[model samples]
Target: MEKDNFDEIIRRSIAIRKKYHELEMTHHGSEWTVEEDALAYLTDAGLVGRDIMSQQLRWPKVGSEAELEHKLGENIWWLIVLAERSGIDIKDAVHNFLDKTETVLK
Candidate 1:
């Protein structure tokens, strides 16, 4: 994707996180804890895994590509939020991974 698209995705993810935090504060009296966010992130990851399996099995009602993409995006959002909470720069982490992979591949 283009830099613009990636930046937009990050912007949208942050916005969604902010909205969820607001809703949680309104209904639950506080925002979600890091642990809660991690658990939710794992749950979404599991759903994505299930979707992949269903697609591999050619299930009649498997999640569509768009649905999978959305789930993956949500997972990314959760990961970014979790990293931020943990005082990690997710962009740096991603770059590190990419750099390592590139070195190994080359």
Candidate 2:
């Protein structure tokens, strides 16, 4: 995809999250914590192990392909939001880092 396409997708995702927040506000208007949100996503991703790992994550069933895929897909929205909130354009960041790596590894 082109730069414009990525930008549009990011923008659309932001809007979707904004709408989610709006609906959430209608129920729990006082809640607003980015740290908490990130933690929630981390748990959803099943990366919260050991100190926070649940049994399902530590021991998946033999045919649990869909569960793994769902967990992986679920946390990306939080990452996208984190990048946006930090004023770090992911496209530029990825391109710059890749370019640096390419040059140094050459």
Candidate 3:
């Protein structure tokens, strides 16, 4: 199996987001919005899934379960983007929260 590396993972995540933009160009080009993206990550990715969710309830899913799971990683990238856009270092924030949780549990 391949080893997991955070830097590489982030790079791959960015690439995945880029592909979303490209696909949107041919499909949802004009209708795409940041709120749509955020909501997609929040609801669709959280519910129907970032992987297999369709553009509509009536349409069939385009991929398999494992492919859908892999795409879910993009949701993490979404939060990372939001944090950066808001001038926060999410890595430090998550570490701080974990440290606080550990202390509370002890």
User: Model 1 misses residue 75 by how many Å?
Assistant: 1.1
Best by TM-score: 1
Candidate 3 accuracy as TM-score: 0.56
Per residue, candidate 2 scores C-alpha lDDT tens digits across 1-106 of 5455767767877887788778778989854477767777777766524213333566544545555555654566667776776788877887899999999999
Task: Give me the displacement of residue 38 in model 2, in angstroms.
Answer: 2.0
Whole-model alpha-carbon lDDT for candidate 2:
0.68
- Models sorted by lDDT, best on top: 1, 2, 3
Worst 10 residues of 2 by lDDT: 47-56
- What is the clash count for each candidate, in the order shown? 0, 0, 0
Query: lDDT of each prediction vs. the true structure?
Result: 0.83, 0.68, 0.66
- lDDT of candidate 1 over 27-88, digit per residue (tens): 99999999999999999999788777667776545455667788887888888888878888
RMSD of 3: 6.3
Model 2 misplaced regions, further than 4 Å: 1-4, 47-58
Please give the range of 10 consecutive residues that has the lowest summed lDDT in model 3: 48-57
- Relative to the unseen true structure, what is the C-alpha lDDT of residue 12 in candidate 1, on a scale of 0 to 100? 74
